[model samples]
Target chain A: MTEVKKTYKHYVDGKFVRSESGKVYAIDLKNEKYEIPLTSKKDLRDAVTSSKAGFTKWNSLTMYNKSQILYRLSEMIEGNKESYIILLQDHGLRKNEAKNDIENSINTIIWYAGLVDKWEQLTGNLNPVAGEYFNISHQEPIGVTFTLNSNSISLDDLVKSFLPALTVGCSVINFSEKNAVIALKLSEDINNSDFPAGSLNIIAGKFENIVEDVGGHVEIKHAAIYDDISKESKTIIGEKGSESVKRISFQPPTSGLSSILPFIETKTVWHPKGK
Target chain B: MNNWEYAESIESEKIVKIEKKYGHFINGEFVSPNSKKYLDTISPSSEEVLSSISIGNEKDVDFAVNAAKEGLKQWSKTSPSERSKYLFKLARLIQERSREFAVLESLDGGKPIKESRDFDLPQVAQNFFYYAGWADKIDLAWGSEISKPYGVVGQIIPWNFPLLMLSWKVAPALATGNTVVLKPAETTPLTALLFAELCDEVGLPKGVFNLITGDGTTGSELVNHKDIKKIAFTGSTSVGKYIQKSLAGRDVGLTLELGGKAANIVYNDAALDEAVEGVVNGIFFNQGHVCCAGSRLLVQEDIHDIFISKLEKRMQTLRVGNPLDKNTDIGAINSKDQLDKITNLVNEGVSDGGELFQIECELPKNGFWFKPSLFTGVQANYKIATEEIFGPVLTTLTFRTPDEAVEIANNTEYGLSAGIWTEKGSKILWTADRLDAGVIWANTFNKFDPASPFGGYKESGFGREGGRHGLLSYIKASS
Candidate 1:
């Protein structure tokens, strides 16, 4: 009897769909191979439109609701840990190593899940100005973030690429290349986690195919690269992003308070103390 | 009725001695530029050439950057406490000579002496003193997560706040253990030149603080210099975007304090008298040359008539004239170029059919000037309503609801600062939370302190310039 094959597609706006371009890239695993959807510029634009709307919906929810949703992602990942470990093994890891990577990835998700509701406190403060005015400097999330995960085949790297941005109220478009099989497979649990439709998107493709569009899309707001792209790509991103003064970060911190710093804007409110 | 006028009490310019010709200050000494070209720095009020400052070319900027790079070794080697002492000493010296710097600032930058004296000079000293305390305690401020300096910094300041902007950029960079190559706006380089002298007086390590004076070309040189690890620019949005594009693909840090058309919203519940005063001060301060100046007035519809009447009455009382005059409420326009820009925008606003109200004032024949102008019945699309006039030109719009006010206030691409006036605390918080601006002033406007972080959201630019947050601008966290 022939084994039933699993189909891999892009997960965007909360549903699993093939790239609008209908193009696929082949990734050869240790013992098996799979062809996954390769995202196009048009697909990226569609993702941006969805993320922009998703930002409003996701950001409007109560902090408690958002935090629970993130925590639920961890639950979903834990429930399917065996599958993730097997998938990581198919991507060239030993069984023990794959299990360890899955365990680490789950712990990362939990860490970000706990941080979802409280990262603002660690990043903002009530500025102590010497006057009779109530001046406080708080923070707001920069919206519609595009994060590129490193090409390393580890699930932990894939999770770190988007979690910090997600933890701060920003809707993330998580893009992946060499690590697409792991990222695309993991999208199953992400779909199960109940993220607001456009809040968290996982797309797989050749980054070179849509590098220019990633930087030029005014609505993206921010482009954070965790992977080491060529100097040419970095230059292209910076040059195009300058037109809109977009916030772009390269290899930003992955843990602690600073990890979320790139995703926030500080806003200070001043009120006079008078009767 | 004749408006009440006070006798002119002109401030003395004798305290500051101006040099006929000035060169770039590099390696703790004045050095002639390799370009051998100079631009005459003028007193914008009188149109008198105060001095000729060297125009820094690529070679000159390279010299300054190289000096800063060489200085980095010693600056990095200096003990944090020792660095703190130097900054403390500079602050003390500034306080003692505050009168001198104030005179020079007004002479060079065309701001009222009352402001340059009571506001800019004091703030400059306070900034240095504030950052001095942070020199040794930076680890405590953020964390020990490897907050290390970006070895050499390039700072470009605008003409509006000349010396104060210098203090804003330089003090923090030095406190964070970075060497600086600073370029002051060509129109107002005297006070920054004077600041370089103080750096020498404090016996700071040679090459630690380098000053290169020139036009936009010079600033581009500094931004493109290979040795500059970070660039902190306070200027127009267009120029900031140009600088950002120039540094593309490079591993250089940038923080821009750019243009803003901040909305000052007055709800009906606000104390009308106090709100009127704030609205006047918000736009008229520094001839509205402030980047974060409240240029757009969003008034609650029901009270719009009453608010405009009171606002115009208060504006009529503003005294416009010489920067040196102690009682001058409005000084000369910063330059002929800026005056023309404001005039063109105002003319366009009139053509666009908005009502224009100019306070009755006689013109000073010698220098650039503009009467305090107000526009009413303005649609959001008018140039005066949307663009940053960057002068004492205020445009008024009316909104019916708090949500509508927030929508109108955030309609612009710029989000540097905003003002909200309401009697209710909950309403103030609600409006502030919804507005996209970086700084929200409730029942108040134009307030600043060393401890408060100030920057913008969206295209108004990025990165805070003051308080604990500012340290991040000069330092990078390594993993």
Candidate 2:
């Protein structure tokens, strides 16, 4: 009997779809019987558009609801832990290491889910701006984030980049190259869960093809990238994103809330409440 | 154009006493610079040299840093109450001599006397008074006693809002028990020099507050000084990036309140009269040299025509003339270079097919002057819409929905401030929630208080410079 090879599509907007350019490449992992979409610049543009559309709906969700959806997504990931661990093993990880990665990934989601409601009180303030006006400031999501990270990143590190942004109500167009299948499987779990469509998009392809377009996209408020890119690439990102002043940060070993805080902008609203 | 002209209401320039030449203020007194080079500080309104200021070089900066390092030893050991008392005395003295400072600010910075008197002077005094009380009570600033002041801060201020920016940087650093080596912007060093006099009157500890006078070279020396513990700068974004790069591998703390091209979104449901007023104040204030100036006007498409018409009519009524005039709404541009930059950008807007509108008024011929102007029909990618022109040039773009308004508003590299004008409460909250800016003014614009922390997101720069949050940049956690 001959085994059937499955072709994975880029998960964008709300559904899995083939690249607009009809480009595909065989997976680099050993013993994998699948190929992933080599997403095009147009596909990346479509993902940004979808992520922008998703931002309104996802950001409009109450913190409680977002927390609930995030919790559900984490549970789905945990439920599919065995499959994810097998995929990680096939992608050149020891079984124990793969299990740890899966566990840490799930834990990261849960950690950020718990922070969804508590972030406001922790950072927000009814500032004592000396005047006759009542001034209050709170953190708000920074719309769509375009993340270009290293393919060598662990699943835990990859998800860490998106979790804080997601918890703050931002939609993410996350790009990965080497771990394409794992990113695709995680997207499937997100799609099946209560997570809103376009809230999280996973694109797998050649990094060179879509980087400039994604970095320069006007709609993307945040861009998280690995520091491994050339100085010329950083300069290009700086020049392209100069107009709207995109908040681009090279990932540090440990981001925690520091990564999340930069992506969350403060909004102080004043009203005439004083007599 | 409105045919309403009033007699000149010039505030007397006799109130300010300009010295023939000035030296760097180090330790407790003015001293000659190690380098003999001097630059004449010129008044933009008259094109006359107000004074010759010593051009501080690398050695001058080193002298000031050494003074601050010595000052920090006793300053850090001083009782918090004593520091608070010193600030209180300084605030009172500033209030007493504010008229002199206002006249000097108008003469040196080319801002209208009315604004210098009514807005700048009061705010300068207020900043001192507000931060004065914080000196003795900094224990309550953070959650625990873990916060400790970073010693010997290097402060570099800008030409716009010269004295007020100094107060903002100086007050918080002192309140948090840190000595300062400040370099005032070259074009407007007189007010800072006068401020040094006030410091002496208050008997602030010798070497506690040192002032260096020079151009960008002097600023570079101060920033790169090895002994300087932290850097606080307010200037152009390009310079802010240079500072960031310079301090990348160093352990020095840094804070920047840089450039901004803010968005003022006026919805169809907004009160048109109030909205128009807000738009004018947001952009035209300080001749639009403000870092948080609402340079981009995003009017909802439904009421775009009416708002633009009303705004134009309002622009016509603005009196542009001598900075010393009591009724002047606009003044001379800060310098010849800044004037050229504004002219180039405005001409670019015209070439790009943007509808240019300017107040029909004759400007003074001998001075650096650019008419208060605006561009309508501006696309998002237009140079006028994207860059910080840093003059009284506003770019108007229309949008149909709140979402589109937000899209246009957030499409800039600078995010220091934004203004949302709508009568609907929920809509204000909704729009404000979506806007990516550090300060969002709903139904109001260009409103500032020393107690309100102000800074920027993204390229607008980082670190808050007012309120309790402002103290964070001056101190670090003990852990």
Native-referenced Cα lDDT, model 2:
0.85
The most accurate candidate by DockQ is 1
DockQ for all models: 0.86, 0.21
* lDDT of candidate 1 over B30-49, digit per residue (tens): 99999999999888889999
Q: Which candidate ranks first by lDDT, i.e. highest?
A: 1
The digit string of per-residue lDDT tens for model 2 on B446-467 reads 8888878788877887778777
Q: Which portions of model 2 miss their true places by more than 4 Å? A: A1-60, A69-112, A142-166, A170-263, A272-275, B1-5, B79-81, B136-139, B301-305, B377-381
Interface RMSD of each: 0.9, 5.1
Predictions in order: lDDT: 0.91, 0.85
Per residue, candidate 2 scores C-alpha lDDT tens digits across A163-189 of: 878888899888888777778888888
Which docking class does model 2 fall in?
Answer: incorrect
Instruction: Provide the DockQ value for model 1.
Output: 0.86
